[model samples]
Target: MTGIKAPSKRQLNNYLYDRRREKFGRAAIYLDELEKWIFDGTTIPDDENEVFVFSYHVIEAEEPSFRLALSTKKLLNIVCSTDILHIDATYKLIWQGFPVLVLGTTDKNRKFHPLYLGVSTNERQEDFQMILMALKKRFCLYLIT
Candidate 1:
């Protein structure tokens, strides 16, 4: 009675789970909002729209995986300045169990700076190739010259 009452831990956990379920159940809405902001120039970075759908795969008419690549002019310059690029993957960041792929490079002082980040259904060769193709297409001129 003296202290403010808070929901029990189990109750709190259930509430969080329910909220997550509701959000995931409406994934389309979330994607739509994100696309609207990006394409409508509301979320442009450095006066440029740098977010791209690097890969999208659907099976049986259901989208299983969607990989979005985030980039910016500054990030791209850092990427091109570094001679070595490092690609790494992490898991369990989301409840869906998709792997988050990170593409980064080190600066002259050996500090790692991430350039592109994506989440994919699996670590298939094709998935990686798709990412590589997108990066190549975007930076081919910078890389060549």
Candidate 2:
């Protein structure tokens, strides 16, 4: 009888995990490298190309502050078309121990539509300016008109 042994359960699981390693296998990649993927504004493509890190502003210093902002095409449309800006920072609930900044617009009905979710390593005026400037840089002409 010709015999070919099938892979064990553990071997199959290991094979699947190895295939998924590029995205989720943290053990194989450095934390800083992973942070770069999450924090840097690299054009990661998908079917809809919806979620991505669009703004990544790093202040060069002895201790750098990394600021990141994420948005979608739909959200940018909302941001450019709307005028009622509602920016708020909620600190109690921290995302990776950093306060999350919310940028959105409120309609006449007071319904909120979040356009950008930004996070900075430091809480300072410059941090606020950086995120606002990032947004302004992208939609300055439209916002002005």
Candidate 3:
């Protein structure tokens, strides 16, 4: 081949799936272990509402079409909730180092886990707004039912 071979659709999907599992699966496992520690009294909290912030640094951009330059980086945060956990994924601006939220959710125990996560340089505002809106919608729904 003259250049790098493009992955077929199936291959691409498999790669993405594996990446997703590696990232989100580890997070889930950590949370489960933390929960156990809390129940077993291994971990102590100063307050009733113990909030833990876990972050992961994404080295590689999952999507290239987003026009993200080489300097771009991504970060994901997980926060504990009463019924479910809240996840927020965003891209850190290279210059200002401000997060541009790309995805946010209140996923059930294990459902709705991310399978393909990425950041886009184009339409960052729109992406951030969409995720915020989605998170609000989910939170409202959770409150109702």
Range of the 10 consecutive residues with the lowest summed lDDT in candidate 1: 52-61
TM-score of each: 0.61, 0.66, 0.24
Name the lDDT value of residue 47 in candidate 3. Answer: 39
Evaluated at residue 22, the lDDT of candidate 3 is 85
Note the residue pairs that clash in candidate 2.
none
How big is the positional error of residue 5 in model 3, measured in Å on the Cα after superposition? 3.0
Which candidate leads the pack in TM-score? 2
Q: How far does residue 87 in candidate 3 sit from its true spot (Å)? A: 22
Global lDDT of each model?
0.63, 0.72, 0.37
Per-residue lDDT of candidate 1, residues 55-137 (tens digit): 33333235534555656555665665667888878774542456788899877788887887766667888778877787777
The prediction achieving the highest lDDT against the true structure is: 2
RMSD of 3: 18.0
For each of the candidates, the C-alpha root-mean-square deviation to the true structure, in angstroms, is: 5.3, 6.8, 18.0
